[model samples]
Target: MSTHFEERSGVILCRTSWGSWYQTMEEVFIEVNVPHGTSGKEVRCNLGSKHIELHVKGQEIFKGKLFGTTVSDEGTWTLEDKCLIRIVLMKTNREAGNCWASLLEGQYCADAWVQDQMQRKLTLERFHRENPGFDFSGAEISGNFAGGGPDFSNLQK
Candidate 1:
């Protein structure tokens, strides 16, 4: 069965957990969420190097490979609330222009960022394992960050 998901308004009302991406200079953030009334216990999200799978209510809503220039499986996932999750896909190239054009046909090690991200993920995992019960909370959960130069069009250049 195929996962059916789409974005409408600021909500992620889904019959299946599909996804949508909005990109920046350095990352692609894919939004996934379960339909209203679906409890957190009823949802599962598997984030991989080249694909992501989201399941809810014991049925898979999303299971698809990702694509793009220099896409790293080394992304981050966070529960926006009790009903939503955000996946952060890092960009390998700073000047690749827009990468949201393609996101379903690529290899994990196809880019240098893959290596870097692998290391990063491993480090984070190790840290968490070593510091069991340590809370890294209160950090910037928002994935939006620097992607390129800031435009000061209203001011004098």
Candidate 2:
């Protein structure tokens, strides 16, 4: 519901999350500052079933899938002035029926991005509504960010 950021190890971390009837999903994005005078120029990571794409300064730099799942993806980058990482995950009705089509029909899709930081911990999450014209209650992100930071620790059932 909100967006928050924190500074750790010369990297800026962002977190966001959202809730639904079947599950609660969260996403994390990281931006690392490359060392001075470096020429490599780009870095990226992707995982899960959601084929994530990463871009630097509006240019596609990294592309890949999240593990064996096609429901999440992430990307990272370091530029001359700053570095950024983004992660996205979706709640999919991969089931074999039309259950999703019966819940969210004709409703405006609501999507949100949030970041929160308290004490020594950071949280980033994104919420997306998968309104497929029909009444489909379920939703998913279809895109995400790459590596860095903790292993999506706050995501729970």
Candidate 3:
């Protein structure tokens, strides 16, 4: 019930049988490994607003609804090293600065540990944005800084 993802350069990368995927605030990157010597014509990908279907060498590698909406026109895929397929999807709501937990809907969600790290990273970024006077680049966030913990607004004697 849990998916393990590796964090690289502040981005959490989820690896699956098909391949691996990672996302930024504005784009989603997908890498699919194909058979050696597989040509570009052997790979077919369809990226819609919320749907994705990829085929390699006539084999269905992945097909499902995306977890978030994207600009279909901006989505692109290219074959690399004659065997790997790299895809880039531009998120439609880039201005909102939201992170996607998974590539496909109801699939590959981040585990508790990953989720916590993501929460902390997002919180740190928000803090830096709101308070630009101070440098919080190296600050580490501990505990439940996102609220829902015990409230101590009023201390009792």
Clashes found in each candidate (C-alpha, N, C closer than 3 A)? 4, 46, 0
Which tens-of-lDDT digit does each residue in 73-151 have in candidate 2? Answer: 3323234444323233443422211111111232211232211111112112222122123322222222233221234
Q: List the residue pairs that clash in candidate 1.
A: 5-18, 49-73, 67-103, 67-104
Off by over 4 Å in 3: 1-10, 95-97, 122-139, 143-157
Candidate number with the higher lDDT (2 or 3): 3
Model 3 lDDT, residue 50, Cα: 93
* Cα-based lDDT at residue 2, candidate 3: 9
Tens-digit lDDT string for candidate 1 (113-137): 4333322332332333334465322
lDDT tens string, model 3, 76-112?
9999999889999988975323667778888867666
Could you tell me how far off, in angstroms, the CA of residue 23 lies in candidate 3 after the best superposition?
A: 1.2
Deviation from native of the Cα of residue 24 in model 1, angstroms: 1.1
Q: Candidate 2 clash total?
A: 46
TM-score of each: 0.46, 0.23, 0.72
**How displaced is residue 71 in candidate 3, in Å?**
0.9
Q: After superposition, how far is residue 69 of candidate 1 from its true place, in Å?
A: 6.3
- Give the winner by lDDT: 3
RMSD of model 2, in Å?
Answer: 16.6
